[model samples]
Target: MPATHATEHSITVAAPPAVVYGLIADVAGWPAVFGPTVHVDVLEEADPERGGEQLLRIWATANGRVRAWTSRRVLDPAARTVLFRQTVPAAPVASMGGEWRVESTGDGTSRVVLLHDYRAVDDDPAAEELIARAVDRNSHAELAALKEAAEQGELRDELHFVFSDSETVAGDAGDVYAFLDRADLWPQRLPHVSRLDLTEDEPGVQHMDMDTRSPDGSVHNTTSIRVCFADRGLIVYKQLKVPVAMSGHTGRWEIEPLGDGTVRVTSWHTVTLDPEGVRTALGAEATPAEARALVRKALGTNSSTTLRHARRFAEEARARA
Candidate 1:
């Protein structure tokens, strides 16, 4: 057996222990809450909120590299702890496991401790060092984000919103998926996209930078990391650099076949607003409600346009066939 290395990172959050625990337990929301997490898929779970065993597939950034892993977790609500072990660890990681503990510190505050233990393949020193660095960086980032989110309390709703738009395509699901997967052509295909640069360093993992022209003729540049599940017809993306009004943003494009040669394509968005950014971009008098509306319109308009174009492309292909 190889020697294992361990690390622990802790933070004091201005929130109740239960609140912090709840945030940690809700793994599905990690992409929006944690900067390193790009996407999470719940493979198996039984009421994760109440505490139980669950399985998850996660795609995240590790030391600037996109990595995917499957984890088995045991959630203990009574103890305010979550224990997880990666069943299929990524390369250089022979095995990885961790525990998330939330402890009450009184006065409506709590302490969050993230602990990790892992070993490198063959116990190679270089591999071990790399794993250590990644664990340290991700742990700190996740804890700080968790602290900020839990402390928001009632104000959380005002900052975060989830919305989606759907359209029925007259062609096959594959065609619609192809339209989204081939985003490199967006500059030529999508009117609002003035410029786009895309690279898939690793299969199914992409990094993109693009300039989009908004309704007011203003152009905003953004960058994102996308993970594609081709067989499942799902593509999840996280914006690394966002507009002035958004603190965090994640979204998905899903294609579902209707079994009769038609498909339903949807674009889903989850956003966390920056109040001061809202004012900066939309004038100081802009209220939170107004910010939500503005974001919804701007984002929805772009998404609806993509769906329409995808529909047209797919239908045209079918007619040509």
Candidate 2:
């Protein structure tokens, strides 16, 4: 039998058990709430005798490297617990399982405990050391962020928002996807892009460092990681470096065929504003509402520009063919 190591980390959150549980159960929102999480997708969900079972694909930063894995989870809302096991663990990890339990401490508070059990392939000491360190670091970061987000309560809504911009293309979805996937050419094709460096060390995964020129002629530098799904006509990205007034940003580009020889190409964005950054960027008395409006306008303008260019590119390509 393979020897397994177990670890636990716990934090006290000044929020109700149900509230904390809701944050954990809503896996789709982890990227915005947690520092290490980049993206999560629910592949399947079903009600089972044990509770609710779900298959999840999660992309996260582990020990400074971006990794992807599939996990099977059982969620018990009444018990305020979630049990998860990695069905496809990333490298250096042979097997991994974990549980998130939220217990009421009374007085409108909860104790959140994160537990992990894992084993390294071939019982290699080096692999074991790496996995243990990553697990500890990520668990601590996740718990701290969870506490901060949960404690924000109503304030979270003001600081976070989702928005999108789109255009219709009378061309193929593949052409639209190609235009978005080829970020390396943006500096030449897109007027707002001044310089961009893109690297794809792994297929379908891209790392980008770009300098974008704002309408005021001020250039802002940003770095991002993007995962592309050509067959699905989708590309999802998370910005590692954000603007001064933003705390987090994640977005996706989708191309959907309308079945009429045309496609709807859309850009979706989710952003969380930073209060201190907002004050610095705007003014000392700047409110969250003002920051929200500024972000919406800036991102929407850029997205709309990109969508228009993509539509033109795709249509022109079709015309030439």
lDDT of 2 by residue, 1-321 (tens): 787999999999999998898889889889888988888998997453346999999999888778999999999988989999999998889999989999999799999999999999998999999999999999999999999889988898999999999899999898999999999999989999999999985898888999999999999999998989898899998999999999899999999999999999999999999888999999999999999988999889999999999999999999999
Clashing pairs in 1: none
Q: Candidate 1: where is the Cα deviation over 4 Å? A: none
lDDT of each: 0.93, 0.92
Q: Ten-residue segment with the worst summed lDDT in candidate 2?
A: 44-53
True-structure lDDT of candidate 2:
0.92
Best by TM-score: 1
Encode model 1's per-residue lDDT on 1-321: one tens digit a residue: 679998999999999998899888889999999999999999998575577899999999999889999999999999999999999999999999989999988788999999999999999999999999999999989998998899889988999999999999999888898999999999999999999999996889999999999989999999999999999999999999999999899999999999887999999999999878999988989988899998999999999999999999999999999
